[model samples]
Target: MSESLATDTAKPLNGRLAPPRTARVVGLGHRLPDRVVPNGPIAERIGVDADWIVRRTGIRERRYAAPDERTSELATAAARRALQDARLKPADIDLVLVATMTPDELTPNTAPLVAEALGIGAGAYDVGSACTGWLAALSIGASQIETGRADAVLVIGAEILSRVIDPGDKRTAMIFGDGAGAVVLSADGEGSIGPIVLASDGGMGDAIIASHEDRIIHMDGHTTFNKAVKVLVESTQQACERAGVTLDDIDLFVYHQANGRILRSVGEKLELGDERVADYVAETGNTSAASLPLTLSLLREDGRLRPGQRLVLAAVGAGFTWGAGVVEWGLK
Candidate 1:
């Protein structure tokens, strides 16, 4: 972990007292599996045309992990790239937080395996907020830095949804993919990551679930879609307000890559133009927890993300969990 003083409070934003210390995203990386599963085959399995899949979910194809691939392997790969991008070694990380609902196993959790693979001795754990997991983990990592609990943290979001989706079930089969993404955060002299607003509605937990009987994901598409759009919009608004910025001030809007329709609807409600909102669901499908970070990596690779840009990140997931946050891009 990097050393830094924490006694001084950051300047207030719109009368909101910022944290005394802030965490800045210094590096980012993502990994997608080699296998590309197009909607043509999936559509045949579900008795729908390829065009129907695209129309409904805006997903033309998605990556699927090999049968031998483990979730931790993807996470470790992404984390290594993030370390390299940050110009830091594994030893510099004080904590490793992996957010994933699909762990390599239930007993040991995924973070430790990822840390071990990276040869980092940092304390590690998992966060299971489903699709909202990455933003939730980011909040946790940033909070640790803000309180001086740790100086450098490695936050990762990884998912192997292909293993859990029933190929015949159109609800999930057409929407899920496999991938991992990671970011390295370090304490900064001024806060770059802003307030994160998190909330949930467990009463709607059944809207998306994976029962023990089948260990396969089931979702009420209509219910999840309606609730997702509403929460995503509301959370983004709340995050902007907390950050002392208006919607117009955001340079980019990155929401969970759940569905193209959902993203478009959220943009319509927010009155944001297409260029301002990210729509990567078409390429990566819904990676659950990996969605947000994966999209972030894509943006960076395409040169859409730059230092000092303001961004709003948001997501809604099962457990009815949802979150949004503001970040000022810090990587050069």
Candidate 2:
């Protein structure tokens, strides 16, 4: 995808503007916990059969961190792998942004802990937008890079939902997993990340929330499905329009790995066939903030994502937050 095809607004607002610096994803990696909890165990605990989980959620298994494993641990591991993948040292990072809903602690933020573990002497912070964390962080990272605030940034989405979920609550227990995914974003002359469309609806916030006492996730499946499908489809189309490209031009679609049903509905609304969408929910379940980046890492590992291809990434999160963006894949 050529930058010239982007809307004029993608360029500088005034004629005397400097040439925009492109922020490109240089590396990607993800880490899932070692313990794989199959549907059978979860089903048994929830008074259902293994087949029921697959039929309802399309989830066969999910990874759970050990008792001692924290969100920072998963994040640091992923950041290390991303640095290795980018062939850059931690010292090269100018900033670190972590997107996570579940942090090991309430204060101090998980990003700083991850940065400290990785020996990154840079600004670090956390972004909390539930499942849309990665996309939101990616947008912020791109802005920082493009505006010359930071030349290199590590954006990570990590979560340990297992710690917060009520194991007895079948709706939440069978859906979430623990994992982290990271991407190294750097300034590039030719590569581009743009047309990031973001929106939020605080009105539907209650559709998904954590219990006040236990912080356990409580969700209204029916309501979430309708809102997610509507927002995701709208954001995706807006992203493509802003990028001055058609949906047909997108080589791959990476929607939030929230639910299999939501993914299917979004694809159908976009008229994108199953082949174009990336499906990782069956294996990873809902890794919350880590979903998008995790899916990207899996696609890279499987050789499905190639350099120079146009990609569209969309997501809808618990805050009623949602977004989509267009990217020209540059990693090799």
**Top-lDDT candidate index:** 1
Model 1 lDDT per residue over 37-102, tens place: 999999999999999999999999999999999999999999999999888988989999999999
lDDT of 2 at 178: 88
How well is each residue in 140-181 modelled by candidate 2, as lDDT tens digits? 998898778998999999999988888888777899998999
* TM-score for each model: 0.96, 0.95
Error of 2 at 241 (Å): 0.6
Worst 10 residues of 1 by lDDT: 1-10
Q: Which residues of candidate 1, in runs, are more than 4 Å off?
A: 1-16, 189-191
Q: Give candidate 2 misplaced runs (Cα > 4 Å).
A: 1-19
Clashes of 2: 0
